[model samples]
Target: MNLYKPTDERIWTGREAGQNLYVYQKVEQIDLELQNIPVSGDKTFVLMGYECDEGVRRNKGRTGSKEGPQTARRQLAKLPHHLNENTAIFDAGNVVCVGDDMEKAQSVLAEKVTQILNYKGLPLLLGGGHDIAYGHYNGIKKFVDNDQKIGIVNLDAHFDLRSNEDGNNSGTPFYQIATENSNGSLDFPYLCLGIRNDANDKILFERAREWNVKYIESELFHKQNTSYVINKINEFCKEVDFVYLTIDLDGFSSAFAPGVSAASPMGFSVDIALVALDTIISTNKLISADVAELNPTYDRDDQTAKLVASLLHFIIHKVSLL
Candidate 1:
C-alpha cells in the first residue's frame, strides 16, 4: 500500500486511493490465519478507518483554524495501514468528504461500520468529527440485544449531548444517541468524562441532569490526581458488559491538543490523560474505540495529530498486552 507523505496535497483516486487509504499491512485479511504475536496472543484485530468530512469547514471555523480537505487526507495517509504484524487492520478510507450529500455520507458511514463489526473485530476508528460516534454506536447496537447494555466512556472537553436543533451536526452525537435509545431502539449506559465547565449548553446540562448520566467535569482533573479519575471510570465500567471508548482531542488542553472543533482552555494534561486511558484499557472490556474531533488546521505544527497518533499507539500496545 502507498503511504502518503504528511504534507502531500494530492487527492488520491481509485486503486491508489484505496491502497493509500484503506489497506494496511499490519495483519492479514480478515479471514486469513492470525499471525502469532507475543503481546495479545494475536486474537485482537483492528478495523481502522476515517469518516465524516462534511463538517470539516464548520469545525475548522469553530476551532479558529483551517485544515481543509487536503490536510485531512494527507494526515490520514500518514497513519499506519496496519499497526502491528499480527493484527489485521482495515483502512476503510475516506467514506465521506465535503460537498457530498449529508444523507449519503451518513449512509456510507453506517454501511462501512456495519461491515467492520460483522467481522467481530474491535474497530479503531479515526474520526472526521465526534458526530461519527452516532454512526459508530448505531452499527454496534444492531448486533447487541436490547437487554445487553453497552457502556460508552466519552472523553471530551464538551458534553455533546445537545438536541439536534439544526440536524445531525458534529455537536449533537450523544444527544442523538440518547434520543434514539429513549424510544426503545439503542439502550446503552453512557458516560461523559473530562468535560470543561464552559462548553456545555444549558439545555444539554438540563438533559444530563434529567437522564442522571454520570459525568466528570474538567475541573475535577485539577481537583484530584489521575488515580481519582481512573477509579471513577472503573466504577462505571464495572456496571456494563461491554464498553465503547471515544476520545475527543479537545478534551486535552489547547496547549496539548489545539486542533479540535472547540479547544478548551481547561483540560487534562497529556500525562494525566494517558493515565486515565491506561486505567480504561486495563479493564479489558473496551469493545470498540475511536478518537475524534481532530482538525489538523488548528494544530501547532502537527503536534495534535502526533499526540493523537501516539495515543492510538499506546491504546493498541496496552490493549495488546492485555
Candidate 2:
C-alpha cells in the first residue's frame, strides 16, 4: 500500500478556449482510501495509473512505458469535457513499482483497485504495461462474488496467454488468469479480439485452444466483419454478470498506434476498434477497463498519446449515459 501514490493535482491543466469545458477543469483528485463517498445515483469512474514497466522489461520488449501514465494524463486533460456536471470522476493516482519487484507492485495495484470497487466506483486504469491486466483482474475478482460470472474481453494483437514459467510478465497476465480459473476460482469466459496471426506463436494458439478461449483474429477485423464482431461481443457480454475490458494499444495498426511496446503492421484500424469499444459499452455490463502498452518513447508527435486520451474521453462520455 505504501507504493500507492495519491493523485497529483498538477497533471490536469488546459487552455480555456471558448465555451468548451475540458477534462482538466472537471476531474477531481480523490483519496482511494475513503469509504462510501456519496454518488448521486450515477455511475462513478476512478482513474488510476500503474507506473511499472518491469513486466515489459521482463518480456524483453520496449522499456519506456513506465512514463505512459503521465503522458496519458496530459493528453486526457486537454480533451473537452463530455460528462455532466455532477458526474463523479476522480483521479486516484499511480501504483509505483520500486526496484524490480513486479509481483509486489501487482499485489499493491490489486489492493488499490479493490479499494475503489469497495465503493462501487468503476476503475479506468492507465497502464504501465499489459501486465497491469493481471492485477486488474485480481482486484475485480476480490470485489465480485465468486458466484458471479466475470468475463474478460481484451483487444490486443497477441493472445498474451504465454506461460509464466520464467515468471510473470506483460505477456503472461492472461495465462495467470487462466491458471486461476483452472484452480476453480470461476469459469474463465475470455474473448480476445484483434489477434494478429504473426504476433503470436503456434504454442500460444495451442494454449488458447487448450484453454477454450474464444478469439476474433485480426484478419476478421481487416475483412470488415463489423456486424459479426459486434454480435460476438454482444453474446459474450450477455453471458457475464460483469465485464473487464482491457485495450492493448498495440492491437491497433502501427500507423495508428506506433508508440506501443510491440507495434504490429498488420493490426486493425482505429475506426473498427472504436466500433468494437462502443459495442462493448452499450452492453451496460462493463465494470472496469484499462488502456495498456502506450510507450511514449516510441510515439510519434504524441499521436499515440492523443489516441489514448481520445479513447478515454469516448469511454467516459458513453459510460456516463449508462
Candidate 3:
C-alpha cells in the first residue's frame, strides 16, 4: 500500500566493530512494495513501525511514538552482535499516519504484517502507540488458521480495556479485541501482567473482569516476587497455541523508563521486567512480539531507547538459540 513509506535512513551502519557488527550492516530491509517482498527460511523477522499516535491523543496521553520505529532502528542497527545462530531480519518500513487518519494507518499495517506472517517471517512491530495492538492482532488473525488459538499477553501499567464507548483509542485496543473474539470462534485468552492499580480506574477494572481477562498487578510482581510471576505466566501460556507479547514501555518505573507516554513511578523494575521477559522467551511459545509506547521526545538521555534495544538484542539472541 502507498501508506507504507520505505526508507533506509537508519538501517545501515559501519562495520568497524568487527564480528560484533550491528544489525544495520547485516539485516536485509525492504525498499520496495510489500507485494514483492521475499521469504527466507532462516530465523526471519519483519520489522514494521506503526508511525501514528492519534490513538494516544484521543486517549489524552503524550504522543510522539511516530518516530519510535526509526528510533528503534537506529538503536537496533548499531547493537553488538549477540545471537548464537544466523538469522534473517527485514525492515518492512513504516505505516504512516496522515491527515489524523489512524484507522487507515492501522489497516495498512495489518496488510503489511499479514504479508510478512504469510511468508513465514515473524512480525516485530515498533510502537507508535498501544493502538498498534489492534492493528497487530488483525494482521496475525489474517495469517493464522481459523482453529488456532491466539493468546495475547500485555506488559503494561493499565489494563487497556477502556471503553470504546467513547471511541477507538490507545486504551481501548484490548477491549476491542475482546469484542472481536467474542464474535468469532477463537479463544480470548488475554493475560495482562505488571498492571498498576493506580494507573487504571475502577470502571476499567470492572471492564477487565467483565471481559474475563486475567491479570497480575505490579505490587504482586515486583522485584521481590518475579519468580512467582514467571510461574503464573507459564501457567497462562499453557492454554494457547500461539503467544503475542506486547510491552508498553510505561510499564517500567519512570526512573528506569521515562521515555513513555505514561510513565509509572511505582512500576516494574528493570530486573523484574527482564526476568519476566526472559522467562517468557524460554517458554518457546512466543510467535510474534512488539515493544510499544516509546516516546523519544520525552526520553531522558535515551535511556528508554537503549533499554528497548537491549531487550531486542536479548530476545533475538534467545529466539535464535531456540
Which has the greatest TM-score? 2
Error of 3 at 153 (Å): 0.5
Predicted candidate 2 versus true structure: per-residue lDDT over 196-307, tens digit per residue = 7799999999878877788999889753688999999998899899999999999999889999999877888988888888999999888999999999999999999999
Question: Model 1, residue 168: what's the lDDT?
Answer: 64
lDDT of 2: 0.88
**lDDT, candidate 2, residue 224?**
69
User: Which of candidates 2 and 3 is the stronger one according to TM-score?
Assistant: 2
Q: Which stretches of candidate 3 lie over 4 Å from their true place?
A: 18-20, 32-37, 184-187
Model 1, global lDDT: 0.64
On a 0 to 100 scale, what is the lDDT of residue 26 in model 3? 62
TM-score of 1: 0.78
Q: Which of 1 and 3 is ahead in TM-score? A: 3
Q: RMSD of each candidate?
A: 6.8, 1.9, 2.1
Q: Runs in model 1 with CA error above 4 Å?
A: 1-41, 56-85, 98-100, 183-188, 222-224
TM-score to true structure, per model: 0.78, 0.95, 0.94
Q: In model 2, where do residues sit more than 4 Å from their true spots?
A: 17-20, 34-38, 183-187
lDDT for each residue of candidate 3 in 1-322, tens digit (9 for 90 to 100): 3678885665556456656467775677685374555655558777888888899999999989888877877778777775433577777788888967888888888888788887777878898899999999898888889988888989899889887987899999988888877866323789988888899999888877776788999889777886688888898889888899999999999998999998878988888877877888888888889999999999988888888888887787777777
